[model samples]
Target: MSLLLEEISIKNEHSFRSKIDVLPHIEVPWHHHPEFELIYIEKSRGTLVVGDCIDNFNDGDLLFIGPDTPHIMKNEDSYYQKKSDLRAIAWVVHFKEDSFGKEFFLLPEMSRIRKFLTKSFQGVRISGSSKYKIIQHLKTLHSAEYSQRILTLLQILQVLAQSEDLEYLASDNFVETFQQRSNQKLYQIYEYVSKNFQKKIELEEAAKIANLSKTAFCRFFKSKTKKTFSAFLNEMRINYAKKLLVEGRLTVAQIAYECGFNSPSYFNKTFKSTTGKSPLQLKGEK
Candidate 1:
């Protein structure tokens, strides 16, 4: 499926929804919604795509995403195996700005949180002490009563508002582009690239996938994602390479081939150009 606008339901007894989600894999395809989301991955390792950002996520990772931002967390191949008993688990919370009240966040006491939520339009990864603190609050919120849940959520937001451990995910320009025009064709292209980047990906193949002529597809892809198709695919490959480098189980040459590079020299060139660090250097530092 292309980009989906998922409709989330809130019970009458709850102003916002909070629950623990467990699955054999992340079953939600690329999708967006009208609610702000905070997710704490309790157990998982996967590729996380938020708007135009693609990166790796593991257990204990936390993210806050704004409304209408297309995103997904796709598990590794191991999670999809029927014989494997691996499970993905996360504590997820979804709420609208008006969930408390239309004017609740506009109050003077809520100024910091209001600003923080506005910044979340670009999506963010919480790390360091901030992530640990929020995880504690999320655990309580997951099992809390109605009023306690409200208090705990407010506490979570408060910590986020005052913290400096936030890493913004999607670029500002990409967020604007996605919000203005969410194209099913563009989403389809993203899905195809994400799945096939390890193999030889031709522009003609992508054009056929989008059902557009090559010239039109180039223009459309650049207009929608603010990057050439080649650049986007290279980014996806380099991101996976970075994760592998951190794992420290492979040599640079092996990692280059594993991440779909035709040669180690070219992989070194591209890796440095993209990340300003050579693969060996990054691995050593890690």
Candidate 2:
């Protein structure tokens, strides 16, 4: 079945458009648009699927996605306390490449801005002091006049161009898979995995989520996520373990069992490999 999706455009008089969206507690259908997107999430938490990257996102996160990149924001149970609750408040800005004119970004003096936009196509998250500036600018953009709004947009781009902690979210093959949109298969696979990863998930069961044969599912999953099913499960388990470890409420063995690992030794190995620190070390470091 196709998942429910919604898009709302906030009023703007400038060349670019702004929006505030509230995604429902369902998988966002796989889709892409030609406009570049700048999204600032004010509330809620979930996994953000941008191209081939899969990462958890929490409140106050800001991300910039390039034009025509396929993406979805998947909110499983963990994102909300109630099924009917709104999981996120986001400010999205979409602008075409020519909105600012080619010369604006291509000027010899705008080398850094050019690089920033180029890198954003693969998806990126902005953090640190720059985030605060962007947030403040977004507030002003909403209230400013036409000329002032354009100035705010320029300020936002300038901040992004100079930020140092920007993180790339997708892999090298992300561009290829991002361009394809036949069905919402990837969204289904991710939702199933997010909800069921705490238990044993067989290939056959996962395949059923996509309504595909086991063999086809295996190949498709690897191609899109760049990891085998087992590997993805391991990562999900370890992510849970990390959360428990940070909470300081569970012992290592308890966490292992709770996260569905068969043995503490295996959990230790995976956790260390994924986080570069032992469970004890992680707890102590925190």
Candidate 3:
């Protein structure tokens, strides 16, 4: 329902932050921040939640997230085993809206990058040759001096701004759902719903999780998620169904029930409405 705000500070009084993190698995919980985020997933596969978009992310996943957009990557279950061989490595970049000064992004020459950043409000997945080019620049950014890093970052943005192979995450109708500074309470609600969404969730339970009254919680949830609680929950369930569909181990009806839909017909309708494809259609496309 809500996400915690993550504060980021760069050392040396830099205007931005960049880091390469290597770990057995990603452990960060759902969160958001004021800085724009660019992350290259060097290793591992997992479920990634960006805004209301939930999907799987694999190695070489490259994307940029807008300020205050909630996101998190949870390693697949196997990655959590005691003796798991998998690992997660990432190159992460974070920068403020004014990283390049107030006038820079406003310049006519920066029109492309300006449009690109504006599109980031919904999250973006960068791909194709431009994605490879950006990864190379991100790799070198850690070693480059202050000036060179800035130049290379601009280059990366320029390439991305011009690229056609990009995917926008989150629905077009999605909007910011909650006010900032709510802290971890929203994340608690998210985690609870995510874990229990496969089962019916009552509004009172959700309100209790958020510590708000049921009447207030309904309005609060809608305001924060740009959709009703039922819609939000259904979207999440559909995301799970998407994963199970790709697994191809279960019938569509079975998958629907597993995803918490009461009937196969309703599941089919909602799946088509949400994902623009029926279960059979998705399977056929696969």
Candidate 3 off by > 4 Å: 176-191, 219-226, 246-250, 262-265, 273-276
Which 10 successive residues of model 3 have the least lDDT summed? 174-183
Instruction: Say which prediction, candidate 1 or candidate 2, comes out ahead on lDDT.
Output: 1
Q: Which regions of candidate 2 fall more than 4 Å away from where they truly are?
A: 1-13, 19-32, 43-59, 68-89, 101-110, 172-176, 179-188, 209-212, 219-227, 236-263
Clashes of 3: 2
TM-scores for every candidate against the unseen true structure: 0.90, 0.72, 0.87
**Could you tell me how far off, in angstroms, the CA of residue 37 lies in candidate 2 after the best superposition?**
2.8
Q: Write the per-residue lDDT of candidate 3 for residues 167-222, one digit (tens) a residue.
A: 99876555344335453555667767766777878988988998999999888877
Off by over 4 Å in 1: none
Tens digit of per-residue lDDT, candidate 2, span 111-141: 8878888778889999999999999999888
Q: How many residue pairs collide in each prediction? A: 0, 0, 2
Q: Which prediction has the highest lDDT against the true structure?
A: 1
| Full-model lDDT for every candidate | 0.88, 0.76, 0.83
Model 3 per-residue lDDT at 214: 91
Model 1 per-residue lDDT tens digits across residues 105-211: 99999999999998898899999999999999998998899699999999999999999999998778767666676377877887787667777888999999999
